[model samples]
Target: MLSRRLALAVATGAVAALALGTAAQAAPARHGGHGATLRTLAERPDLLIGTAVDASALAADAPYRAGVSSEFSSVTAENAMKWEVVEPARGSYDWSQADRLVEFAHRHHQEVRGHTLVWHNQLPAWLTSGVADGSIDAAGLRAVLRKHITDEVRHFKGEIYQWDVVNEVFDEDGTYRDSLWLRELGPSYISDAFRWAHEADPKAKLFLNDYNVEGVNAKSTAYYELAKKLRAQGVPVQGLGIQGHLDIQYGFPGDVGDNLARFDALGMQTAFTEIDVRMTLPADEAKLARQAQDYRRLLDACVAVRGCTSFTVWGFSDKYSWVPDTFSGQGAANITDENFVRKPAYTALADGLRAAARRAGRH
Candidate 1:
C-alpha cells in the first residue's frame, strides 16, 4: 500500500510562500498582446501575480490574451516537466513542448519557473510498474531518478528562474509518501533529488512543492520539519510551493496571516502557487461569496507576509482548469467562468491587493 504522503502527493501536487517585492503600484491594463500574465504584470516591480499556462493556450491565436494576464511578473507551466513529457520512453527524451514554453517566455521577456523536476504522478509506465514488479531495485531506481533530475535541470539551466526540485513528497499525515523513491531508495531520494538539481543549476532556486499546506496540519507540519532540517543540513531548498486548491465546502484557514508569517520567520520565501478555491457541483451565490472571501484571505495573507513573493492561480480561467473533470462534484475554481468573465474571486483578489498596497504605504 502507498504511504499517506505518497497518496496525498498523487492527490494534490502543490505550495510556495514568497512575497518578493520592490514597491506597490497599480498595474496598467494591456490593450492587446499575446503573452502570459507575468509578462504583463512585470510592468510594475511591486506586485507579483502569476498563472499557469497550458500548451494549448500558446497554440491558440487568442486575441489580447496577454491583457487578461498582464498583472503577473512570473510564469509557471502546468505540465511541462511531468515524466511523460520529459522522459516519454524511459531513455528517449523530447524537449519540444518545454522548449517552446521557454521560447515563449523569452519572446515576451518574462521569467519562467520550471513546474517540477520530480513528481510521482506523471512518471512513465516503465518505472511505475517496473518498480512494482521488483524489476528495478533501489540502486537502479536511484540511478534513474538522479539522472532524470540532473539532466532536466541542466537542460533548462539559466532559463528557469526557479525549479520545483522535489515536489509533492509528503502525505497529509506528515510522513514521507510511499513512492517508488521511498520504496526503492528510501526517503533519502528526496534530499538526493534536491542536491542533484542544485548541482545541475546552482543559479536556479530549488523548491519543495505540495498542496494542502495552507493551514496547519500533519502534512504541513512534516514539511516544516523537513524544510527546517534541510536548511540545517545546508540543502539548496529555497522556497515552498503551497498548492492552494481550496474548496468552499471546507472552511478557509482562520489565521492565514499568521501561517504565512510563521513560514516567513523560518527564513523561507512563500508563494501562492496553484491557487483555486472550488465549490460543490451546481455553484450558487453563497458558495461564490465564500470563495471570494477565501481568495481575499489568501491574498491578504500574502500581502501581510513580507517574504511572500509570487501568487499564481493554477490557470487563468475555469474553462481550462483541471479540477472540474478531475474531481467529481467539484467545479467553479478559477477566477473566470467557462465563458471568460471575471468571477467574484478575481475581483476579490484584485481588491485585496489594492488594500494591501494601501496598507503597505501606511506602514
Candidate 2:
C-alpha cells in the first residue's frame, strides 16, 4: 500500500490537474471576457481549491452551480452534513440533502469534504435532550455517539475524502469546551470519535476542525498538544483543519504558515478548511483591496506548506455567505459578488494560486 502522504499527494495532484484542465476548457463559455478564471489560475497539480456550497443553491441557482463547478476542485456542504441535518431525531436519519450535495460534487468531478460529524452546535433536540435528561447516561451517550460516527462514515465511505470528526472542541484558553459531549462522555470523546470514524471508513482522512486556530496561539497550541497526544496513543487523527474565517476588523493572522508547519511536523496534513475574509458593511475599493491582500496571504501560507493539500472557501459567493447572518455589519466574505462576478479578492486568489503553481513546478 502507498504511504498516506504519497497517497494523498497523488490523489490531490491527479484530481486538481483534471479539474483545472476541464474547467479551463469550459472557461470561455462560462466566464466569457472575464480576466483569468479561478481554474486557470489554479492549474496546479499539487493543490486543490474548493468552496462550501448550499444544496439548495446547487439545485436552484444556475449561476452558483456553474461558478462552483468551474472554479473549484472540491466542494463542502455548508449544512447538509451537520449532525442536526444527518440525524434530526434519535435513530432517525436523513440523507437526502447530503446525498444531493455529494451527487452534485461527483457530477462536477470534485471531491467532497464532509463538513462535520461531531460538533457542539447544530445538535438535534433529541440528542441534546437525551443528554440533558436522565434518558441517556454516560455509557448510553457514548454508544449513541459511536453509532452516529460509524453509521455516517459508513454511509459516505468512498464518497467523502475527509471528515471533520471533532469540531471546535477546545476553548480559546487552551481548555476543553464544556460541551454536551465533554460533560457527558468526558475528554476521551474526541479520541473515541476519531477511532470510531476510522473504524467505519479507514481510508477517509479524519480531521479536528476549528475556528480561531489559524495562528500560533493558545487555542492552536491546545490542538498541537492534543494532536501529538492522540497520535502518540495511536489514534486515527490524520489532519488539522484551521478554519480561516478572517475579519478585516481584527486583521490577518501573521504566523499562519508557521502554524500549519507545526501541525505538518506532527505527521498530520493541514488544510484551510473554511476560509472567508470578511469586512464591515458597505465595502469600498480600499476594503476590497485589503481583502484581496488577505486572500493572497492566506493562499501563500497554504501553498508554502508541503502538507497543506486543500484550501476551501466557506462559500463561493457573497449571496450565500454566512457572515452577514452570523455577524451583524460583517458581510462580503466571498470571492464572488452576489451576481457571481469575480471580485478583486478572487483575482488575488487566482494570482496567488498561479504563483504557488510556479513555485511547485520549480520544486
Candidate 3:
C-alpha cells in the first residue's frame, strides 16, 4: 500500500495539476525519435530503450505513428494486460482493449512485452472481496489462477515476446509481499505462475519483475535465492527485470553492475524494467543534472551486463507518468516534459547508449 501521504496526493489530483508543460509545446504527435519500432529497439546491439503508453492516447487509424515512439524493440503495456483490466470478473474475460493494443503493435511492426500475468496490486474487486472471507480454499484458488493464466497466455500466443510471469512478489524487506498467492499457494506460487506461462506460450520468454532489486540488498538477495533455486530445478525462468524506479535525492546503489552480473551468472537474461528517476517537486538545475547522471548509471549497468536484454522507462513523458499520482513529491520521473519536449535525461540516455555501442564494437 502507498503511504498515507502519497495516497492523499494521488487522491486530490494535486500531482496532475503540476503538468509538465502545455500540450501546445509538444512535438507533433508522431512515433519515436529514432525512427524505430519496439521490435527494432530490442534488436539494437546496445541497450533497448522503451516507454509505456496508454491505449487511449494514440489514434486508432495510426496508433503507432502518433504515439511516443522509441528505438526500443520491446513495448510493455502500462496496465492493459493486468488481471484487473483483462479479467475483471470471475471467469469472464475482457481482452478487447488489450487485444487491440497487441494488434496495433503487430501492425506497426513491434514486439509486445506482456506487462504481467500475476500481481498483487490492481486486482479485480470480486477476487479481492472473495478472498476477504479468509476461506479461500486452495483448490478453488488454484483452479481460478490456472484458468486465468491459461486463457490469457493462450489468447496472446505469438504476439507477446515476453511475459512478466510474476511481478513484485517480494517486498522491500526481502520477504514475499503479503499477497493472495502467498496465502493460497505458499511461496511456490511464483514458480507455478512461470511454469503455467511457459506451458501456455512455450515460445514467449518468462521474466520475474520487481522494484528495489537493482542492488545487492535484502530484496535482491531474496531474488537471488529464488532465481538460484528455480534455475537448479530447471524451472524455465528466462530473465530478471530490475525495476529502476529511482530517486536522485536518495543516492543510487553503486554496485548495480555487480548485482546484474550475479543474476546473469545464474543464466537468466536481465532487463531494466519500469525505469524512472523521481525527485522532489520543483526541479532545479542540480537535481536535473543528478537525474541525468542517475539515468546514465542505469543505462551503464545494462550495458555492462552481457545478458541484459532491454531497458524500459515506465512512461516516456511527464504528462503521462504514473509517478506523480503514485508517489508524493515525484512529478518529474519522465525523460520528456508534458509538451513532449526532450529533457536533459533523454540526451544522457542516448549518449549512454552510443557510448555502450562504441565500447561493444571495440571488443
Q: Could you tell me every candidate's TM-score relative to the true structure? A: 0.85, 0.91, 0.85
Off by more than 4 A, model 3? 1-47, 59-67, 134-136
Candidate 1 Cα errors over 4 Å, as ranges? 1-47, 61-71
- Candidate 1 residues 4-36, lDDT tens each? 332342244221101111111112232122222
Model 2 error, position 119 (Å): 0.4
For residues 44-79, write the lDDT of model 3, one tens digit per residue: 533445667576665432323344432344467888
Tell me model 1's lDDT, rounded to 2 decimals. Answer: 0.71
Residue-level lDDT of model 2, residues 102-194, one tens digit each, is 877766666788889999999889988877888989999899889999999999988878888999999999999999888887899999999
Number of backbone clashes in candidate 3:
8
**In TM-score terms, which candidate is top?**
2
Q: What is the full ranking by TM-score, best candidate first?
A: 2, 3, 1
Whose TM-score is higher: candidate 1's or candidate 3's? 3
Error of 3 at 75 (Å): 1.1
Cα RMSD for predicted model 2: 3.5
**Model 3 lowest lDDT segment of ten:** 16-25
The lDDT leader among the candidates is 2
